[model samples]
Target: MNSTTQATLIKVPAVTLGFWIIKILATTLGETGGDAVSMSMALGYLISSALFMLLFVAMVLWQIRATDFQPLRYWATILASTTVGTTLADFATRSLGIGYGGGSLLLLTLLGLTLFCWQRLLGTIDITSVSNTKAQLFYWLTIMFSQTLGTALGDWTADSTDLGYLFAAGVFSGLLLFIVLLAYFSHISRTALFWAAFVLTRPLGAVVGDFLDKPLAQGGLELSRYSASAALLTSMLLLIILLPQRAALKTH
Candidate 1:
């Protein structure tokens, strides 16, 4: 590759309003898409997780190979993470008999460890530092853990707490908004808030997606998983095309 290609722009997207909009939508799509595979197709969580993990690996490889940011590729990688996250969380929480509480705690611990390791190695967990190979590896690892945690947390809130889907969605949405308030008015670290908001977005999407796809008896809209996933996918694509996505400013 040429020197210009070698010294490419940041691979991660900039932190913009459009980025969050697409992120939340992509995550919701993840929930619906994952359910289509694991539940609707009766593939079981194990098989569905394996399938989505393959796609995640492929997308991550493609992402690591590309010298510059590509919006579609980045979003594809995000989608892969969330889809795999859904089934993986299900396998751990349900299939392995861990229950949602155990699953959430375990995943949260793993996420904390991942971040601690990233901090040890990189000295900072700022998303903008995700420019080189090593940083990207840490970035994706943290994302996977956060995604899994979100799934378990969302399920725990909805099922174990008996708050139902809408209320669960509201709960997470409120938490995210509170984080936003901190980001705006408080002296808290933006990096911390970024990760906080990032992790919370998944659960918000999780409950909303469940609300759409679950049966009427279950307090959901009773929509078809395939149809719901397709609509969410289409919305993301439209937003990607319609909005602006710039590469994060390089700090390395």
Candidate 2:
């Protein structure tokens, strides 16, 4: 296909600083919003997970059927996936009595398997190649797993260790910074780096969200989850509107 046609086929946004900024905010919003429903409202993790899972499925379907890139639609789907990830992780770790470490291990294994299958089927797990329906399926599925894994990792680092929320956030932030350095200064695979950074951002957002909303006795600020979620949502929307993202060009 010609460049024009290839460009038209691309539906996901380009990987830019703006994209990462908005993504972190979306994940933070997901944590607070999910907690608001499941914990604050006393809906329980299982019920909340079911509700968010349905919403996530609907958003993915909408995204898959779209003919062109739509920023709002794309971010909405991301937000849905993150919210579901939060509740699902909570249910697995707390309700199932698996502990945060066990939950993180399980989700990490699932994410790795998804990526392995996606690579074996498509020959590449690069986001730039996600222009067709098959690739989109793998893309969203990988994201779902990654988001869930991230939530688990965040909780593990914060609660299961001496790191607490702020320290856990710092650790993830440092790791992400290391990835950025590798992207600029090393010869490592760009695709690998992208995925690594993408996965790490979720935990960073998770810890930050917990720090914002969890009780002060637990090393948090005890802010209202609803208010925190609203603030994060507003920030994401503002960034999306002000810094319009373009579709990632197909490389394959």
Candidate 3:
């Protein structure tokens, strides 16, 4: 790695209320935007996934090549992953004729495999050590799989388990709350808790997004997906503009 590259490591954001709010909003926007292209615009899941995957690759390349962390660029990459996740999950569940249960199971297995391989190769799952190219690659790959898994898990809970979208969202949110408690009060491994919380947030966002757009009979507010996505996008943009996004300090 270059001297500059060695100085720049991917660090987790401070665990704050604002961070969680932005994360949930980003995930919700991911669901609505992904659905807009794949379902509302009549594009098949395969095509949508391909398009978003390409976009994700480009954004990740840009992020990885940058000398230092840029919050806008980093978050853009995150959004791309979520969009790709949505389409990939939809393809597996609907297009491939896998029911929600099967899709969730398949994604869960893939997620576990990714984590296993990553750990075997890297020896650690610490985000603080993600200063090198290989570590960053593994980090992003794990994120993609987790997001896809979240989509399927969300749908399985809402549809197959008959929990309803609102209730499913509540369940995930409650789990997130527990993670927060663990982080603050318990002596759990921070790395493990971080990944668990990160994975759970995706599904929480999915369920909340569904609850907003689905039919009244399905326990949703029945809002327009496009409008909700637009609003969320606008909010994110405004926050990015208003907040002070500083790069991580270079370590010796």
Candidate 4:
């Protein structure tokens, strides 16, 4: 392929069942891993965020330089973002003393700002057009912020709103179903709907993970975090191995 062709060849994975499975598993692991470090290990949110942010930077650099979509590397980058998101949300809600509602509001604002800036700079927010380095950078930035927002939103619904983790998960899941319906039945832009669904899945995973690990008194299953994390990770690995992986096709 010529330089022009390569320039338009975005390194992205096809959207499939495997993609969604790995995404949810990664988000769930994010919750467990974040809690393991910040709450269980008593590292505190600030320290945890700092640590994961460094990991995010390292992984993102690796991801950018990669010539093609390597599943392990790409998912590792996603995992880093989710882990960072968990700690960042915790810091916003606790150390910063913003509380769940306040932290969620602030993070939502940041998410919106990131999207707005991306749209302004790129002139489009379609994932299909994320072919160049600049657009890829913006895509990841939006993802990081969206993950953080999802964490805060999950916590807000579970704690401040007293909906409990399971209920909160249900609410988010319902919203996801609605989004799917819209994508199928409505004239809404598929690109926009895709991003919206992607962002919503993070929170759904967050609440579901919390629901499994939190204490019984807190409306959780009282499961061991390590056990839950291991199970999810194993499932994700199995799916990734069993399913066929395909790179995004050249549109033109």
Counting clashing residue pairs in each candidate, in order, gives: 0, 0, 0, 0
In the range 205-225, model 3's lDDT, one tens digit per residue, is: 898888888889888888888
Judging by lDDT against the true structure, name the best candidate.
2
Candidate 2: which stretches are off by over 4 Å?
none
In order of appearance, the predictions have TM-scores of 0.96, 0.98, 0.91, 0.94
Answer with 1 or 3, whichever has the higher TM-score: 1
Give the per-residue lDDT digits (tens) of candidate 4, residues 1-252. Answer: 764455435666777767877898899889988888888888999999999999999998888888777777778899999999999999998888988888888888888888899899888877766777898898899999999989988888888889988888889889989988998899998778888888888888899889889999889998888888889888877877788876655454
Which candidate's TM-score is highest?
2
TM-score of 2: 0.98
Order of the predicted models by lDDT, top scorer first:
2, 1, 4, 3
Residue-wise lDDT of candidate 1 within 1-252, one digit each (tens)? Answer: 443443364688889989999999988999999999999999999999999999998998899988899999999999999999999999999999999999999999999999999999889999878878888888998998898899999999998999999999999999999999999999999999999999999999999999999999999999999999999999999999989877877454
Lowest-scoring 10 consecutive residues by lDDT in candidate 1?
1-10
Question: Candidate 2, residues 82-201: lDDT per residue as tens digits?
Answer: 999999999999999999999999999999999999999989998888988999999999999999999999999998887899889999999999999999999999999999999999
Scored by CA lDDT, what does every candidate get? 0.92, 0.93, 0.83, 0.85
Specify the poorest-scoring 10-residue window by lDDT in model 2: 2-11
- lDDT for position 104 in model 4: 84
Report how far off residue 237 is in candidate 3 (Å).
1.8
